[model samples]
Target: MTATCLLPLFETSYVAGEGPDRFYAWPDALILPQKVRGFYVGFLTYTYHKGGFYLLEGWFSWFIVIWTVILLGLMSIGGYFMFRKFLKRLPKEDGMSILDWEEHYINETRHLWDEEQKQLLDELVSPVPELFRDVAKSKIAGKIGELALEEKASKITEDLIIKGYIVATPKRDHKFLIKKLNEKQIDYSRYQSLLAK
Candidate 1:
């Protein structure tokens, strides 16, 4: 804790503000000792040590120590709140695993297929062994979700039909063109024309 005297016993000044000059003066100078305690009690004593005239003096005063302590406390509180605000502004981890994110994407797009379409899809993959059909369907659904999320295509039932995952029933007039599932690969040619528009 550092201390500074707050009282100036003698002060002289000249002022010229919108008028003739004005002069002010005080004849005596009060000097405080190099050390004092509890000066903020609002009263303190000093001594006039000028011209070899040693005279004790008393005056009202509030020291700088009190103001310094008050300012430091306010600054500390402000700093704490600022640090908290900075922490809140930082980005937070999402805590979602990749598989969880993929499942969430799948769930969001599941409704794109109508009830009839879903039933047809179920029937299409039914030829796989019962134990493996669910796994195959899940893999297919994951692929579909991936494509949809990439904005390449949304409805994959036609792709599956083209790929022969869904057996095409014979039509009376039109011959169905089917490629075997083993030969299936994602063909973006169909979407290229749509995206060009």
Candidate 2:
């Protein structure tokens, strides 16, 4: 596992953040090293001359190593900026990422949803914007499914779905949820217990 600790150090030394290289290299770097020894990179070859590592293999290998390093550095640094530019960091709930929590319930109880509940779910998420409609529907459905499992209910129901939607939504988005509920003529008074929270 010496390569495990050393490869990324050598690769990322020229980069700022953990680049795609980290993800891309692990399958080979960490896994192969367990089956082989010594520093074995594709382009970055090393020699034990004078008891020090040097890029003195040849002009071509030297250029390849330099090119690879520069590319890795740019990608590692760019990945962070790209993350800021593209991805939205969802707030964690109960000390877990929202996406993680979403997968948990969906994996556990997705079969609990019947065709009627699925139809109702489509209607409920109808008012959501097209871009986020899928996420909203999945979140609401995941929560509903989670509640059904928690309460040991045999099947999902309208009340369970409504309650799950409220609990799954953040307080800031409640206005939209409330507005949609009003448009759909769903009563919030019955969910007064959840609303008060």
Candidate 3:
């Protein structure tokens, strides 16, 4: 013997003078659940009511019941197969799970690494040997992190230098000018005449 359950997906009720006047005149249908021969059955009760009193009540025609059963069965089967397929597509433990790596590493440093940098690091570390991949990836990520920090530091330094020059601070301005001249390979002799003035 098998036990079945009745689950109501939708239902609505209206008391006399509590609902819209249109609902009172409209024919109402009640879908009730029944257990028969170990299977749950849906019985539709069509009722005609006037002034909050039922004038007539009868079961739905056989054609409607047959069609409803067919549709429900198809929907149930389709939902079951879809759920199975979704389960099969989930990440499995075979040692090549990106989700595992992401959960372990990326989730922690998400704020530090942007999508582009992460993609670049992945591209750089992908061709490495499997034994060294994790180490290589970590090294690459660390290097990228250091580079970003250095870039921000240099920008701050440059801004400070510019502000110093704007304020006519001789020491900082002279140091930056000298650095620029050295980078351009310009001889100090070229600026000696201006300095002499």
Model 3 lDDT tens row, 1-197: 32222223124443334333323323352322455797654453233333333211233344556677899999999899678646644676775343354344433444665465455445434545786677545543433333335455422222322222223223333454456546646455544443333
lDDT of each: 0.46, 0.65, 0.44
Best by TM-score: 2
Instruction: Write candidate 2's Cα lDDT for 106-197 as tens digits.
Output: 87887777899888778777768897789788888778878988899878888898888889887676677678678878788888778768
Q: Candidate 1 on 79-184: residue-level lDDT in tens?
A: 9967865654455578654445546656877766667656655755665679667755655565556656666455646554333222222232111122222234
Per-candidate TM vs. native? 0.30, 0.47, 0.25
Model 3 scores worst on lDDT over the 10 consecutive residues at: 1-10
Q: Which ten residues in a row have the lowest lDDT in candidate 2?
A: 1-10
Q: Pick out the ten consecutive residues of candidate 1 with the lowest summed lDDT.
A: 172-181
Error of 2 at 192 (Å): 1.7
What lDDT is reached at residue 144 by model 1? Answer: 58
The local distance difference test score of model 3 is 0.44
Better of 1 and 3 by TM-score: 1
Once superposed on the true structure, which residue ranges of model 3 sit more than 4 Å away at CA?
1-42, 51-60, 95-197
- lDDT (Cα, 0-100) at 152 in candidate 1: 48
